[model samples]
Structures are given as C-alpha cells and as structure tokens.
Target: MIHILYDRKPMLPERHKGKLMDNLIGNNLMQRSKKHFSMNRKLPRIPINRRFIAYVGDDFHFVWVLDFNYRYVTLQTTKNHHQLNLLFDAENRVFLDCRLVKTLDEKSRKGSIYLYEIINFEDALECPLSWTRTKSNKFLRKKPRNSYPVKLTG
Candidate 1:
C-alpha cells in the first residue's frame, strides 16, 4: 500500500520493499557505506612555501616545506638516503623533530619530495647558527656587534 518513488519511478514494489530494506540493514550496508565515506576523508593541509634546515647527524641539508597539517609536513629536498631527524625553520624560529613517512620521486625535478610526521616541535627566540642568513647572502653566524653607536652622558 506504500509507494516509494525514485526518479519518477517506483524503486521497489510494495511487497519487495520491506524485504529489501531488511536485507540492506541486516547486511550492514548502511554502516559500511558510512565507514567507507569516512575512511576516504583526509585532513585539510595548510599550504606554505618555506625553507628549512634538516639536520642528520653532524651534517645538515636544506628542505623546502610545501604544506603541513597538525601532525604532518611535506618537503622537497635533494636525493638523500640518510634519515632526517631535526628541522629548523629560521624565518619562523621553530624546530620540528620529525620522522619520514613517505618519499616521492620527481622526474622533472632534481630532488625528491618527502612527507614527514612531526614527532616533537619547539619554538626558539633566536635562529640556529647553521641556518642563519647573513647580510652577504650566506648561511653563517653573524658576528656579535653593536648596530648603533652608544653615547655616554653623565
């Protein structure tokens, strides 16, 4: 006696309607569909274009930060087999201890792209010496000197 119209046509006849609904519910089709939709959802990432210094052992390498979220970051760096341990962002004065999650190869570019999961993060008031940029466009520690002359008045 009930009518279910779909696209100007009845989806199912009255006798088959209850049976189909019961079968779909009993098979957990609705729950499966919900889970499928939720599983494909991805966290939104904030896009950024910045450079960071990744330290591995005593040596360091430069990496370009492309995008990031709360727990993950995407980077582009030279082809390196060594694991990256620490990342220092000089412009932001933040340090990120991260682990590599994935690496993607670029055919058109010279370097490889990487995805990292941040294990720990810290902020600093001063930039690290190895990553600091000087006025001469070099990555060197600036000498400690007074920028202006001090006048002594007694």
Candidate 2:
C-alpha cells in the first residue's frame, strides 16, 4: 500500500521529504473511502464523494431529513422545537456504529461488556474492516456510515 509505505518514511529531509506528502494524500484517500459501501444491488449509483443538502435558519428549526425511499422517509427532530425547512451549508455530519467492548462501571466492579458502537466521524473512519467481512453480507458497510436511511445517524 502506498499509504502504508508513506507513513513509514523517515524525517530529516524535512518539508521536501516525499513521505510526508504521500502520507497526507494517503490520509485523504482513507477519509474519502470511509463512507464507501460495496453495494452490489441494482440500485441507482451515487457519486464517490459524500455530501448533503441542509438548511439552518435562526428563526425556526423543527426536523431534518436524512433520506427518502419508496418505502419510507427518515426524519430527525431538531433540538429546538421550531417549524421551518431551512437549508444551510450542510453535509453528512452524523454517524453511528455498534461495537463490542470491555468496560468497568459502578455496577460491574470487575468489568462490563457491551456493544461499543457509538463513534464520531474520524474515529469511525479509522475503524478496522476485519469485522465487516462476512460470508452473507460482505458488501454492506465496507466503509464508514455514509448516505441516507442506511447511514449512521445520531
């Protein structure tokens, strides 16, 4: 992987060292790929990048739409209980996931176990792909949660 090789380079050549630039490019590549899914279904193809149309106004804010499909449309209630459909400079800013983890709490003196799914964009992007691979649905969720309906949301 060029990205991997780039990260393992030495410093000293400083600003002109090709490795640092390579790593930056690699990091960007990984960031872009975070939301990619290996969907094999005959669905309308979406572009490679991720973006959303959002509206934000100072006057009113009631609900937000994640996406719409023939079956149903997903809506998210805004923190402020106002009613208005406003579109601001918005993009895919919400994300979610489920993961198994070990923890210690007041109830569990030794340790507690639970699915540690909740995560932010950056952390979610760096997540390993090992668990995503399965014999049945290997194509789903190959990358970070992106898009609507099937995306990761708060």
Per-residue lDDT of model 1, residues 34-94, tens digit only = 6453323276676766676778778887778887764677788775534575555555646
Model 2, range 19-134, lDDT digits (tens) per residue?
77888899999999898768353433222111223233444333334432212223343232222232211243332322223221223342222212222324334444333244
TM-score of 1: 0.47
Clash counts for all predictions: 0, 11
**Model 1 pairs in collision:** none
TM-score of each: 0.47, 0.16
lDDT accuracy of residue 123 in candidate 2: 39
RMSD vs true structure, all candidates: 16.1, 24.3
Best by TM-score: 1
Question: Model 2 residue 107 lDDT?
Answer: 30
Name the TM-score of candidate 2. Answer: 0.16
